[model samples]
Target: MNQPNTPTRVRAVLADDERLMREQLRSRLTEVWPDLDIVAEAKNGLEAVELVREHRPDLVFLDIRMPGLTGVDAARQIAQLPEDDSWLVPEIVFITAYDQYAVEAFEQGVADYVLKPAERERLLVTVQRIKKRLAQRQDGASVPDVAEPAGAPLQQLLHKLSGQLNPGAKPNYLQWIQATVGQAIQMIPVEDVLFFISDEKYTRVQTARIEALIRKPIKELVDELDPSLFWQIHRSTLVNARAIDGITRDFRGRQMVGVKSLSEKLEVSRSYTHLFKGM
Candidate 1:
């Protein structure tokens, strides 16, 4: 009698900002692909990148919009890793709620994405495709380079998003912010703001004179603010470009941004490091 050949085991990582979503995805994956081993789970994009570097999983499912670093930003950094790194670049699968990026996702042929609340049938299809690709790699067959066609569509999508956020028809940037100061409502000039940090509920507005809180989150404010005047140094942090005195390096060699006349320093994550590339 011939011995049976065991199926290949696939290692994977899942990154999502929501714990429930991660659990749901893991549960679904387990039902559809039992051989797929989920080695780790991340709650944010930064954690996702770190987990990928640590685990070197065969595949990673990243949520498109995560706090600290967006999934696209994380994927870009992973793709740019040095060739000599010990771990192979894992196949990426973006999990997003928006359908607008479908065209761009298709252009990046290397990636296979699933929409949020991943349907079992759709995930089964993705799993099959991933398995095929992995088999090809193991057989020493040439895998199509998905990264090659990714650049143009990614750039186009970014340009379109930027234009949509700040259209020429709405050239006026938000000049004043209405925030609660103690019991009274105060209107602060946008220029006076040093930075804006968002939490689950509200955004902290920091200025030279006072600190205030608002119900608006960073996502909403980004569309209203002037991109040239304000730079998104991190997913949750928006710094006034004019207020940026300089960027310094911490002991870990990570970039720390200093705002003019402000005591606090903003730590720049890997995703937004490009904004201060030349500096």
Candidate 2:
């Protein structure tokens, strides 16, 4: 017996600070995708995140420059959100003004982007791409054309976009650390550090030859270090990517990262496991 497949009902959430921009995007989206259900709207990134958590929309259109928690930040948080039904993660489409550099960065990533003052032609292209991705998921097949490839994770793309928007935000990452070794403060070259494990009080900085203690926590270090160089495997641990020896699974089948020149393996928290998806 043959049965016709029902069309998938696509739901979406829109986030933008300007009312006019939101309306414009909504109207255009409706024109391009009349069947798309605009489940909710948000005025800022924070609100967008909350809306996503509530509605679990299939798509999210986020404005890059928001008051607090820029679109990139919101996307990072959304990516780490708990996934249950295998549908919690929605396809993200960034909304931004026309910036040559920003657009160039977007082209290198898997996610699509719409310029401010949305154009019908461009929106149509984005709509088509989104439809393809959603259809692939529904069919229980891999996204042949849009899957995250090497150097194209959402986090990496967000990092590039954030850098483009805030050029001087972090010109140079921490190159050296002042850590206490008994009575003396040692100048530990950041490259020498294998991993950082932080507790309530101090963070332990380990290297092949020596270990030291620093007051800076892993959170602060994450912001101060170049993300391309250091990968945050867990909330309390950040390991240098270049220093990674390999990856292995523990007894519980949890992913663990092995550091070069280090015997102890660091566990990758469930939230940050996407960073090692190659495994």
Candidate 3:
């Protein structure tokens, strides 16, 4: 038996880069609302835009990351539909691995966002929320307004990001160490160290002392250091973020960046090139 002319039923579109997420959501949606029609599925945010424009589904489930545009970025774009109330704006539900972005998405007027590997019970709740909104729509009501900006709370969440330096941990942050230059030994600050150069036998800390012998290998030191401050430029070299002063293009269109403390240039390998762009 079928419910005929159920104009109030929620028709939806689904978008995610992962096939498993799409399939799982499809099955879950069927379990929750057997009558709900999923009109289309998109592989990426760009395609999601095209699909929404063409199919005009009543709802969409979008992923945060894909090959091209991100779901959050895409949602901001779709929310810009013509101001005239020619057609009701479709409801949206975001699915993401990162919980930190939930505040931003919620602020952007998405009805609800769910973390991936969604439990069936939670999915039903979201469906119920949608139903409640639509019931009001059938009678005549405005959608729920977004909660107040969570910018302050977001700062705490964003602080979970990696590469924080804890100077008090074990050994002192190794500020000043002795290095042998020519015939004399000189003291140097760890901050002044441009890079650590490693060899088969030992590692040299290239501070203003010209190059000091470090007790720890470059590999071991990288593990202990804050990753944001120091980058492993090569298997043999670890560079300080502050030490880099300028960049240059080689004849081959590759890059070689120079450090402030030393005359020697550092090679930017393809794998590590993105670090320079971020800088």
Candidate 4:
């Protein structure tokens, strides 16, 4: 970690497969901290490692999960570089959209971490600390514990892992999904659904506007909704995007995705706007 006032130039490398996440992160990092130079950026772990060796940056901000090798695997490779390896050991900061590492990032010796939708203030704070740590390392100072916040993040990650392990083998995006209403259960094809609305407790699956209450949460239902056609307009609703006639904002300026086959309109949250990439 470099001293806060040190004259050191920070060399960095960034990695993520999602083009938006990667480009945005790099652009923001460059804009905010002009002293830092980004040597390379990669779309996957293998590329990241290759870049790491090529550039030998002083720090790396990495996304842990990628198609080929995980961020952790890349970290291990960084950790295992032989003494004769010409590159100096660089510090690591992790970034993730999933809450999977909110706890583990801290537990590990990682320099820092930022959750998705990182704020400018947070980025400034993180960058300062990283530079400070690098300065301290160069000055032969002891590294302080930058452990993660305990308990809650870990619990959330465990729950997520369990959910993934048990993510119903029966994918929700099927043309038909199992439904139970007042002890009468059956599989309902998507074509049968008139619309879906989120209630405080459960999502109401309506067919022809006759509501059938189901216990499945909307988050899980998002996966069930066909990504290619169905869209989650709001946290409370999932609408068949293809079925959408037009989108209009309501009296409050909140956007709604309206369907052609049904009068009931659904909300579209900003976070899910990406689902409409082409449409």
Clash totals, every prediction: 0, 0, 0, 15
lDDT of 2 by residue, 1-279 (tens): 432122368899999999999999999998998989999999999999999999988899989888898887787777655556355478889898957634644565447789988999999988876786566455543322434442444555677777877888864789999999878889999988888998789999998988899989775776577777788776678888889999888897678888888789998765455455555
**What TM-score does model 4 achieve against the real structure?**
0.49
Ranking by TM-score: 2, 1, 4, 3
Please give the range of 10 consecutive residues that has the lowest summed lDDT in model 2: 141-150
Q: How far is candidate 1 from the true structure (C-alpha RMSD, Å)?
A: 12.4
How well is each residue in 1-279 modelled by candidate 4, as lDDT tens digits?
A: 324554358889888888898777877787678888888888898888888888878888778677787665566465333323234457777777665564455543333676776667778877876776676555443333333221221112323333453557433446876777777887778877755676668778877645577788765665455544554455566666447787676786545676775787776554233233223
How much is the lDDT of residue 15 in candidate 2? 93
Give lDDT per model, in order: 0.72, 0.77, 0.62, 0.62
Regions more than 4 Å wrong, model 4: 1-7, 83-87, 107-109, 143-279
**C-alpha RMSD values across all candidates:** 12.4, 5.4, 17.5, 17.8
TM, every model: 0.51, 0.66, 0.47, 0.49
- Candidate achieving higher lDDT, 2 or 4: 2
lDDT of 3 by residue, 80-157 (tens): 343233445466687877675554445533346777887799888777766655554443433233332212111111
Instruction: State in Å the error of residue 93, model 2.
Output: 3.3
Cα deviation at 107, candidate 1, in Å, is 3.5
Candidate with better TM-score, 1 vs 2: 2
